[model samples]
Target: MYLSTRIDKALFPTAALFFVYFLVMVWVNNSYAYFLHEYMGAAQKNVDFEFVSYLAILAAYCSFLCSSKIRTPGDLVVVLLILVLVPHALVLNGANSFAPEASPFSGVPLAVLLGVSLVGLSNKIHFYERDSGEDGRRYIVLLASINIAVLIFIVLKSLGHFSLDFSGQYIRRALARDVFAAGSPSGYIASIGTQAFFPVLFAWGVYKKSSFYFFLGLLNVLVLWGAFGQKYPFFVLVLIYLLMMYFRRHGQIKTAWLLFFAIGFLLLGVVEHEITDYSYINDYFVRRAFVVPSSLLGVADLFASNNVNNGYSDTLIGVLLGSERSDPLSFQMGVSIFNNPDLNANVNFLAISYLQLKYLGVLFEASFVGGVVVLLNYLYACRGSFLAIPVALLFATKILEQSLPTVMLGSGVSFMLLFLVLIAAPPQRRATGSPQQ
Candidate 1:
């Protein structure tokens, strides 16, 4: 019976879903590679076909592991599989031009292995579950109000510099940097508001079927985009809404649909690029989102080999350890690799960990991240809260460009975890609402 159950779980809908997802990902990967080589003249070298086949086999096995473990749309393993591991797999598939000198064999497989291990190990180690029984709605509303107030103050403070013109986004982004410099109160507030408070409020609104809170959350997203000139909030808000609606209707998260949407959007961008001779979507969404983060694994690995490891000096733990400081890691990477001092070549956490302590750092970071995933999954399982989806999604995206410590603390995920804990309702509430209602 145990063996039968394992086979059933591994081969049925879950495995089939990921199989389709993987196929779409491969198409997306090949399409992007062709775009880079043909249109951009990047002269990207394709890895051995045998090597690509090997990576595909590995990815298939990892997908099986992930399929067996995924319990919800909000699962950390889901994000790791889709956002982290898929990109790395694609990188090995003739997409390594971002670091020509760096070995494609190194850094990426380690990251993939760690990701698969996390998927396998998740829910294996159990944690104590507790519910506060507090009024989740009340606390969520209070938090939203406070974040809204803070956002208003930020906008008022920068009223003179504010410009909503999309074309002037770069200038406004620079202004935002000056206004909300790192470690400043405004910076922290913006992170918390955007990453935690607003997302939760928006999700809660969806749950309660409250149009007021729903549109209010969207209005805040616009305010944030106008004030900070950051475009992620708009995209993330839309994604959260869609995921929430899907979950509500299906009563389960379907990984295949997510992949279908991703592939659809990607192909749309590619078609637009082909027709108009424009590459903004290709550059920003395709290259920046997937290719760069994956290629940075090799770049970070190569950089770490020749230089002194950061010894956690780039994080809060480094400050506590009194480690000596230099230019930020992203800036250093930007200057060294891209020859651009102004660029911030931020990368995924695995690469950042490798930069800090090489292979051992990767292991430690993976373990830490896996533990956090388990904790978040525990909370979600106990409460079955839709709000966890957005928070987890935010953390997943942040990790694509930030270090683990920065994603957890600076990006306000730790605070969001606390918020999840505070707002966790009884398991009984999970079945209270129908999707149609």
Candidate 2:
């Protein structure tokens, strides 16, 4: 009886979250299928909505089981999976009609289920004892200072002639793209500063109630935005602030609230579009942000199903094996689907995995990603620092769009993990034996 009661307690919040999430998915799926399809030329197939609804429900159930508890990083990943991956999975089912050879049903659902289960199981495994110690604030400051120095150097070298011009954002973005073209070292440094270092500084500021550091971090974000003409830094800043504020008040991050706010924002966009016929919100948020990316998965599946798998040739493993180089799978997919060689249709990790090794690739990628989530959970548990929450959230967003290897190595999430560890490390003893500040 006691065990059953505990199970019920664990499941109650999960059930409520699942209900709201399901409704949101249904609404969004319908919008994608009909409203956006007709209005914005969004991709869709003639697949039956009833069949897609059933698949979504099954995926949602798997998500619910994975999200039975939400106190850990793994649980948070499941929430993201529910929001991003499940929707993509539904789109894939419809896309299968467009690419029957891909047979998305053969592996997508099983991959998601396995991924969620592994993450949940790994989250429950405790690898380290909690250290009841002061946070490594000094180290964070040191890291932030180093990041600032690096940013200054990069700006002086690469962006010396550029000035902030929000009014001409597209022009500025084109210039920024030229400045930070692929394989540029300064580009990588700038990415690390904005995506990893500054966010951590800002989160630390919020955790310590330091308004000066908070503003400092925010100013750096604006500077990076102006310099790079990238909007994601601002988005990351807002997301981190919201997460920090929520965690401060509630003592835990609630997935339901995240979903609720997201749905509410989308609903407001829908209303705005209906009232004013202004399609900015619908175009950017609904179509560009979610629908376009989700639709690309179908395109990727089609390309991968009909062609030879890349066999990991686009990654470092290929370099180690001396495999012949080829255009990245994203660029290849873009060329195949849209006949645009310059276009890159980067999809989520699952689609990327399938492109690399077919169904078996999905299983390996799922397990690997699950392991990464476990490591993040372990780091958060050991540190007990609220700052880690925002960092983890940033990393989670990366998973939604990029493959695990790219997110970790190329996008500086590995550096974020390193920062978490450094911030949790023990401080050195003073030579003078004075009381430590």
Candidate 3:
């Protein structure tokens, strides 16, 4: 049953308070252990400034989310970020492998916070859902044709015989390695299309009780999620599905569903480790998958090293403008390559923010990101824009978790192009001031 009291409204504020409590406790005990402090230097100013900046971004995001009445995908995005970040903050065991005095959070916390909050604002329009009238024999043939075609292509490409490693390890470290070579056109198609709202459309099919669409959608999610070997996005997809189901039906985010999802996630992790080895799980899951805080710290160190490029990296903007294109990881992590080849190359979007503009520039980029989302809400609005939610969610993830500039330059910009595919008129056409159809 839908509760009259919206618990989600409290989520942002509550999370903010949770972090505050942790901070207070850490300070009081004189044992504040966060890897960010370790990497940015053990000095008080490094951690203090970074923590203050983080608090400001959190306040801004919570303010925006709390202002809105209905639940949006931003709610889940914010929570997922906290889940990724806070635990990393709490656990600190060793000295940083990178710089001991690098304060990355001072520049980046806002990037992620506002990046996600913008997704919520960008989807203020209602979902423009329509009834798909009948599932005739022709409909079955149409769905099956594309579904089978895509699935077969994916299966063949993944096989050992094909020898095409689209497995995302290329962006990990050095690019010169033989394993880092590029893949076929179909590989690029699958990678780019995966982050769009393909699964949401399929889920709509499942909601319509089309078994063909359901299985196709399910396999699409599996392959896309497994491509990276990180399960965070996999479960994030599930969370998206749950939110879509709830919002489409106008219901509360159930406690039971969250519990079930958490348990299932834990079970999957355990099962994988049990089948494999702890070394594999720790290296991939703990170290690489949870690389944000440490990677951000390293980027902060890069800033301190005075390795700033004179101009914008010239990659993301070039790609976005149709001039030059490159992979997000390689392009963003170019500076860090010489410092340490094996260093985490997935330095996140903030690295681009820093490389382009350095410290104060991070703020400009964060504001630019947040403002762009708000502008997107304005540009893409419709009377009932169903497609906006999942697409915005994808965009938010790209900005927050991936390289910010490259995404804005590459797949992120391409997502907006969907308007041409999905809309017959300009977004302004269906707006309220315009004549209603």
Candidate 4:
């Protein structure tokens, strides 16, 4: 006798359905009026609604496959991007529109539809959940030691430059320099603290409902995001915990929901401190959030203006030192010429990859993204636990704005990530709200 898994049987039909949906969205799509609106007496659209709606449906489907658990900082990123961020971007992008009308065919609908299909390929997958135990003492020690040392350094640095001001001075000062060096305070936080420590600890705190880990996670946020004037570190973590308590209440105490309000109240304080001017929302949501979509302009411009540089030299720099890490003369010239700073914000992974390797770069970038979905799905297939979802989200987060090369090569990211993922507790027998012992 032969047996087949649910995924095996459903794969073809799902793929066919995805293809048909793509066609329908593309064929029956809206005209210029659909994606854009009149603003300031001009027709301008920032986001494509058809795209956002399509992605939401797909994300909902993907969430259903993952058992609909949203319990990690990483999960928040994916969910918020699909639910809150993208939609917000769509609405706000139109706020500044000066165009007369929308385009005949919008890539927003097609791109998101395609993205949904690609994301769905990871459905029905699973991973092994390695349990936390006494055997991991050395690993705990390793993390603790690093955390302590960095904490001390960050404190000293803060004291050396302490002030009661929140006039964007601190943030402006900090962001002015390269913060990715091992010796620099931010390099440790952004690269290591944010990547390795915060996610792992925050996940543990929410999973176990332990104050020790919870506060510890906040400390990580303090040095990396909070002190730097970035609120996302704190925001993403608290959001994940609240969401978990609401969605999966097994280990959670009845009073845990209080933490949600507490975090929110505190977050509002931080937001007030960070706002510099009247354009805060425009700066944060319109300019910052929509970078990924607006980034398509950079890619298009690069391809339109320049002959392919063949990318041989830049690719080497990208892999070894991350993007423009060494900043060789040739690399500097190339960035200025091809990946022009003319764009208001950071470019997306697609633009970075194309700048480095042209069409071949896009292929590599797609494959890596696809691989992430596959690996995460495979883990889910094996374990079917909550842990699998966040870990996958964490890995995917690295690719959202940065190129794969930057993510892979920067900091001690690869080694530290291995430690974080390997040390996670194994999945419980069933995927449910009950706390893990």
lDDT of 1 by residue, 154-222 (tens): 788778678778897788888888888877888888777666667767876775788977987787787
Question: Candidate 2, TM-score vs. the true structure?
Answer: 0.84
Over 1-437, each residue of candidate 2 has an lDDT whose tens digit, in order, gives: 00011232435555555556555545654553335643322444444566556655664555445544356665666677666676565433443334433343555444544555555555455434355466666677777787778677657765653556677666666676677765577767767766767777887778678887798788777777667666667777887788777666766676667767777866777678678876566665666556666566667656755788788888877777898867778888878877888677877777677778776787788777777766776566555554556667777788777777777777788887776776665433223332111
For residue 56, what is the lDDT in candidate 4? 50
Clashes of 2: 0
Per-candidate clashes, comma-separated: 0, 0, 10, 22
Q: Which stretches of candidate 1 lie over 4 Å from their true place?
A: 1-5, 8-48, 68-70, 73-77, 101-105, 123-135, 270-284, 383-386, 425-437
- What lDDT score goes with residue 76 in model 4? 36
Q: Global CA lDDT of candidate 2, please?
A: 0.64
Model 3: worst 10 consecutive residues (lDDT sum): 86-95
Return whichever of 2 and 3 wins on TM-score.
Answer: 2
Better of 1 and 2 by lDDT: 2
Q: Please give the lDDT score for candidate 1.
A: 0.63
Off by over 4 Å in 3: 1-17, 20-70, 73-151, 161-187, 202-210, 224-233, 249-293, 314-344, 359-368, 375-381, 408-413, 424-437
**Per-model TM-score on C-alpha atoms:** 0.83, 0.84, 0.59, 0.59
- Please provide, for model 4 over 63-92, each residue's C-alpha lDDT reduced to its tens digit, 9 standing for 90 to 100: 333222333333333433333222222222
Sort every candidate by lDDT, greatest first. Answer: 2, 1, 3, 4
In model 4, which regions exceed 4 Å deviation? 1-43, 46-116, 124-141, 157-159, 162-164, 169-190, 225-227, 250-283, 291-344, 377-389, 411-413, 424-437
